[model samples]
Target: METPIDRIKLSQTAKDQLLKLRRNTKIDQWNILCRWAFCRSLAEPTSPSPVPIPQDSNVEMTWRVFGGEMSDIFLLALKQRCYNDGFPTDKETLATQFRLHLHRGIGYLAGDPNIKKIEDLVELATKKI
Candidate 1:
């Protein structure tokens, strides 16, 4: 991705603002930015939203009215379930939650695993060859 030129340029005010943000923030803010990029990467400008809305409503409302959020919605649902279940959201709890989804999600993302072991794979390949 190209670095967008700031019309404000490298003014002292911009530099100071960035320094303040860095000191206050714990995590790298750049990775969070990638999520916005990933979401935008999905759709094209040519394919407009099916439902149009009034001029007054904001962009967030615009998305809520006409668009679907695959990633953000999944995360929001995940947190909501965690909230209801009273889980601490630590490694163990997350692992258990992940297992429930992973088992099903993997089946859809990857083809069904017929063989369980590398030995089985080698045996099958040798027989075929």
Candidate 2:
């Protein structure tokens, strides 16, 4: 499956949040944390806000790195989300939605007071959506 985005660049605010998450969860790899964040956003019932997210931070990763072994699954999930939200599956729309969901998830994870360790992340993942 082809992904709409080739490269992923995060906002400065997201970078700071991920830094904190790393210190708290001890998950050093950006891609792993990103996968968690992306899924976290996907689990939400509401659509992500459409506000523009500035990619001013230096943190960057290829789509391959971000999705790792589950690239196709992530792409399918994004496509499914777009379908569920009554959005077009065009590259532009997919790309925009991907960014929104990713950033929103990061914010959710960072803001959650319960996410202080890796086990907390696991608990969250195991919870019913």
Candidate 3:
């Protein structure tokens, strides 16, 4: 089993932007984008695939594709922190902390706002291909 679709997929706006770029450049758009992309999974893995998290039982999946997981690490850290804290009050400080974690979480919530400065860099790396 996979996590719920919690993040955003590439938006139509981004597609429009890409279309504009392709038109302006008068080029085969996919060619340029493909060169820089690093795809994670084009579909769900087969029966013997590594579990995304240890909590999940062995399972097989079948899907066409999904977004990258740049933010997963940071989100995990945030989860760890939250679990350790035993559900602290939802304060601004806590928000800030989570924000920091999300920054590093690559598109952690798919189109979610990045918490760290690095997200922008990653965004550029994946931008829209």
Candidate 4:
């Protein structure tokens, strides 16, 4: 399957948030943290607000790097999300929503007070939503 986005560039805010998450969770890879953030946002009941996020940070990754072995699954989930949200699944829309969801999810994770360690992250993933 063709991915809607080829490259992802995060905002400075997201970069900072991921840095904090790194310290808290001891997970060093940006791609791993990004995967978590993307899934976290997707789990939300409402669509992410269509806000503009500046790609001002130097942090960048290819879709393959970001998704690793789960690239196709991530793309499928994104397409399904667009369909469920009543949005077109065109590449442009998918890319836009991907950015919005990613940023929102990063913010959600960074702001959560309970995520103090890697186990907290696991607990969060296992918790009833």
For all predicted structures, in order, the TM-scores are 0.24, 0.98, 0.21, 0.98
Candidate topping TM-score: 4
- TM-score of model number 1: 0.24
Predictions in order: lDDT: 0.31, 0.96, 0.32, 0.96
Predictions: Cα RMSD each = 20.6, 0.7, 15.1, 0.6
Query: lDDT: which candidate is best?
Result: 4
Residue-level lDDT of model 4, residues 1-129, one tens digit each, is 898899999999999999999999999999999999999999999999999999999999999999999999999999999999999999999999999999999999999999999999899999985
Task: Pick out the ten consecutive residues of candidate 1 with the lowest summed lDDT.
Answer: 1-10
Instruction: Name model 3 segments beyond 4 Å from true.
Output: 1-8, 34-129
| Model 4 misplaced regions, further than 4 Å | none
lDDT of 1 by residue, 1-129 (tens): 111111111223323332343343322342222222222222122211223222231112121221134544634544445455666555455434423432222222123143343343335334542
- Ranked candidates, highest TM-score first: 4, 2, 1, 3
Q: Rank the candidates by lDDT, best first.
A: 4, 2, 3, 1
RMSD to native, candidate 4: 0.6
lDDT of 2 by residue, 1-129 (tens): 788999999999999999999999999999899999999999999999899999999999999999989999999999999999999999999999999999999999999999999999999999875
Q: What's the lDDT for candidate 1?
A: 0.31
lDDT of model 3, residue 2: 34
Error of 1 at 20 (Å): 53
**What are the per-residue Cα lDDT tens digits for candidate 3 across 1-129?**
232223223334334433443443444433232112212111112111222222122221211122234334433433456556554534443434332332222122223333223344346556566
lDDT of 2 at 22: 98
